[model samples]
Target: MSAAVERARAMIGVPFRLHGRSRAGLDCVGLAALALGREAPGDYGLRSGDVARAEGWLRAAGLRPVAQGRPGDLALARPGPLQLHLMIGTGAGFVHAHAGLGRVVEMPGVSPWPILGWWAVE
Candidate 1:
């Protein structure tokens, strides 16, 4: 597996918490920051802004935007460094933290949600 995928998978079972980003507890955005080792902006809320804003922030971070997510792109779907949806791309799936599931989980297939964009981490 790719390093990003492996790192994200290692976070499986971590508890979900709003604005959380640690191994003990992590929200979606937090999970992405931890896996990518980058500081995400605070205004990045999951439901706060449109996908364009989210994509703009990630682009400002020097993360290359890809037309499609590959096996190691970092995924984001909210605002704030700790309060958004975060995941790691794997060719066939993605690893992310889910509030409903109460832990990080590997989801097979590209996310059906409208993704803002993907950050190449590997």
Candidate 2:
């Protein structure tokens, strides 16, 4: 597995918190940043409409948009009409901080939401 994937898996079960950035609590963006070893902005709302800002952060972190997600890649998904969620890709699943679950989790198989974009460190 990729080092990023390993890093993400290590955070399973962490409590979810809006705009949180640490192990104690994390949101999807925070989890993705921690797993990918990058810094993310905290000035965002629960229902963010600024996809360009998020994309900019990903790009600034040395990630490039890719055709599809593989292990260790980042996925931008829309779980709701106004919700933009981020997740780390595992070979067979994805690691994300699920607000509804109140913790981080690894969901197997295809994504449950519609994927908007995929980004890779390389």
Candidate 3:
């Protein structure tokens, strides 16, 4: 498996908390931040005040927008590698964040809906 995939897998079963960003508790964006931290130590620009602010923060962090998104792009779907939504790519099928499950998980098939957008960590 790729290092990114390995890192993501390591986070399985972590607890969920809104605006939380640690192994003890994490949200979708927090999980992405933690994953990005593994590759490099830098501020993920997460702010607790507003969730909408996250997109701008991520854009500032160097995530390039992808007009066409896919499941393989999940790890690179933001300025930081956050798996926030379901994506269909390769054989692993669909990838998405399951807040109830407290971690990102993959479904083995194409996504039922088209990807809205994507970004790659540069």
List the RMSD of every prediction in angstroms. Answer: 3.8, 1.4, 6.3
| Residue-wise C-alpha lDDT for candidate 2, range 58-78, written one tens digit per residue | 787889999978899999988
Residue 105 lDDT, candidate 3, scale 0-100: 69
TM-score of each: 0.80, 0.92, 0.59
Q: Candidate 3 clashing pairs?
A: none
> Scored by Cα lDDT, where does model 2 land?
0.88
What is the C-alpha local distance difference test score of candidate 3? Answer: 0.50
- The C-alpha stretches of model 3 lying farther than 4 A from their native spots are 38-54, 69-72, 75-91, 94-96, 112-114
The most accurate candidate by TM-score is 2
- Pitting candidate 2 against candidate 3, the one with the higher lDDT is 2
Clashes of each: 5, 0, 0
The clash tally of candidate 3 reads 0
Residue 66, model 3, lDDT: 72
- Indicate the residue-level lDDT of 23 in model 1: 81
Clashing pairs in 1: 28-86, 29-84, 44-79, 44-80, 45-79
Q: Candidate 3's residue-wise lDDT over 3-104, tens digit each? A: 444555566677766666677876655666555442221444333333245456666656656766433344332322333332223336633445666666
Q: In angstroms, give how far residue 12 of model 2 lies from its true place.
A: 0.2
